[model samples]
Target: MLTYEEIMLLITALASVFSVIAVYYAIIEKNLVRAVVFSAIQSTIYAFIYYMFMAPDIVLVYIPVAVGLYPAVILILISKTEKVEKQ
Candidate 1:
């Protein structure tokens, strides 16, 4: 049987992998909106990792800042800039 900590470690590892992939995709995305969305997805995965670490306070703060406010700000900036990359 996996210990609780070991299970959490496993989940954390998965989340880390997912976050890396999400970030990489975000980086390569030509569409600014899509990139912002992908960044939010990565933030959401980080929030889950935070929750798994038993840090609800961090999750609370991180979700709004990382996943919500940050993305919204970027999207707003994108609206003022360009929706899609010119290539």
Candidate 2:
């Protein structure tokens, strides 16, 4: 069996990979809403990694601002403009 630290490292590594994927998709996505969703996904993965690293305080603050508030604000701004990005 893996030790606690090893397991945590593994999880953090996986989460980092997923966050990178989310960021890539967010950048390439044509729809503004979908991009926002992808950005949120990336932020959530970062929060999880933060938790894995035992940073509860940072995670607590990050969850609301990055995962919740920032996305909500971006979505509202998106709603005001065109849904799809023009080439």
Please give the range of 10 consecutive residues that has the lowest summed lDDT in model 1: 78-87
Runs of candidate 1 with Cα error greater than 4 angstroms are none
Global CA lDDT of candidate 2, please?
Answer: 0.94
The runs of at least 3 residues in candidate 2 whose Cα sits more than 4 Å from the true structure, single-residue gaps closed, are none
Q: For candidate 1, write residues 36-64 as lDDT tens digits.
A: 99999999999999999889999989988
Clashing pairs in 2: none
> Any idea what lDDT model 1 has?
0.93
Check candidate 1 and list the clashing pairs: none
Query: Which numbered prediction scores highest in lDDT against the true structure?
Result: 2
TM-score of each candidate structure, all chains considered together = 0.91, 0.94
lDDT of each: 0.93, 0.94
